[model samples]
Target: MVDGGGAIQRTTAQFEGPRERLLCLGPAALRTDELLACIMQSGNGKQSVYEISTKLLQYVGGVYALADIDVAELLSVPGIGRAKALQIAAAVELGRRIVHKPSDQRLQIRTADDAATYVMDRMRYLKKEHFVTLLLDTKHRLIGEDTSSIGSLDASIVHPREVFRFAIRRSASAILCVHNHPSGDPSPSSEDIAVTRRLEEAGRVLGIEVLDHIVIGDGRYVSLRAAGYMDN
Candidate 1:
């Protein structure tokens, strides 16, 4: 192609889309929209995959926000159909599982900070609250973890039986409770304190210690024990 300055430009360079760029420079070099486009695979007749992917991101706010959206919501986007929506949802779920997956090396939750850091990435981007239990062995190393309840935007209905049932099953000597605030603020609600105290009392009866309750925010975390909420 000839530019206004009469300089010959490589037309091929201009035609290189995300796939070509990804092949040349790797996925890490592609922008968020480009990555989404690759997952989408194709676009509607009138629009390019790049345009569709960009619109999808804008509609949901951002790439991180995609994690919270379901297939029904994805269908509302201009160029996304059932197939594309399913593909995108699957991709998001896979990403979530990968982040939440346990490592080959067992993780030890020696302190509240350790527990918070362990669940931070998995919980931080969620749109709804999740009450998760970190079941720790005698040495405070993670033996297993489970989500006790997934609830509304602000609350999870957690019962001591549900929480301890999983702990007893896993043979956990101590439990670290973790949950997230979709609002991105780690401040403890009155309900949070009440629930923690309830769990602590239950733990005492079961002879299992409640180490702490860690509230996860956007990138911040608050340890209820450190904040004096777990004092006897």
Candidate 2:
């Protein structure tokens, strides 16, 4: 009997669990850690790729933050080589672009969520505020999207004359003003409200309807029209 003295015990078969399930199934079935492992491909001989991935996620703050990281920063991780970093960065850019594309032909802006979904991916990643105007034809189809201004975080100046000039040039029947708030809050500020009002009044005189002014945050947004700020 080895009750008092320590004994070397023979190990049984390894228990198959979540981690094994992740490796056996695929990246799609895996958690964030498992997905990172697929990107890493391999790790130092001392640790498995999944173990290395878990440590990297902890260092980077999480998967969401990891998505925002550049190649240089990702390469800084112990197990991530330059090649792996580039692969991850490329995957992120692909995902970002895919989210911005609308699969269907319908261009209707039926709700605030619809407007936000259209602009969030494009604007959220931008470092500076971009004031863009989406010109729509009478059928609510997108004619064009133009960047009116790019400026510092606080605000981007917009002139009604310049805005209408583009609208008239494009022969757009209606317009949707879109701008990003880098602060990641979709709530409209006083200045935001003021700008929307100015654009609405200008559109009234120009015979071009201003359908909405949308403010895009990181993953959220606000539609001035839907909030009853614009007079339809």
Candidate 3:
């Protein structure tokens, strides 16, 4: 007797509601294209969800490649519109964060390099400026992180109140600030220096030490403290 092995046909001939299939077999059992089709939920007038997902996977080379795919690239595909593209992007980001999330013990930030490396993968590719604060315990172990601001950084938008709110809640002994430059240049502007100084002052008043301010670029980073901008 001979046996044939082929791809599992988990759903009906018409591609519909892998949601029910997922509920029965769980996510791990579904194929990658099927999983993507589930995330998209529906397709455009021209194609079915499954066909669009297969095209997307082929265009990007594979599922892991989606990690580095930008919205423009996703939109370039035949059936992917802004809404579906954003949905896929959001799902990808959530999965990335979850994978990088620490286990039993919290990760520590011991130096400027450590801080920058921790956030580089998460913030490096953002299209706009994102100001995030790393809350730390006495030993400098990371306790929490807050994305306090999402637009261009300035005194008003990256205000002291928003920056330190999460730190206070977590009772963090110190904070290391991180933000990304969409232009992929880590050079500190005058505003960047001014913002660091202001944050340091606020940290003093609030009894939370401002350890460093790291500016993340494409694959590079600049630590404000290392550059003497935080000497005062």
For 1-232, candidate 3 gives per-residue lDDT tens digits of 2236754554463334677778767899789998998999988989999999999999887885687677998999888999999999999989997978786988889999999888888677766788999999999999889989887432225889999999999999999999888778989888888989999999999999999999998899999998999964
- What TM-score number comes out for model 2? 0.59
Q: Which ten residues in a row have the lowest lDDT in candidate 3?
A: 7-16
If scored against the real structure, what TM-score would every candidate get?
A: 0.86, 0.59, 0.70
* Preferred candidate (lDDT higher): 2 or 3: 3
What clash count does candidate 1 reach?
0
Maximum-lDDT candidate: 1
Alpha carbon lDDT of each predicted model: 0.89, 0.77, 0.86
lDDT of 3 at 212: 96
User: How many times do residue backbones clash in model 3?
Assistant: 0
lDDT of 3: 0.86
Once superposed on the true structure, which residue ranges of model 2 sit more than 4 Å away at CA?
Answer: 1-23, 44-52, 55-60, 66-81, 99-101, 111-113, 117-135, 143-173, 179-184, 197-209, 216-221, 226-232
Which candidate has the top score in TM-score?
1
Candidate 1 Cα misplacement greater than 4 A, ranges: 1-15
Query: Candidate 3 regions off by >4 Å?
Result: 1-38, 48-90, 152-156
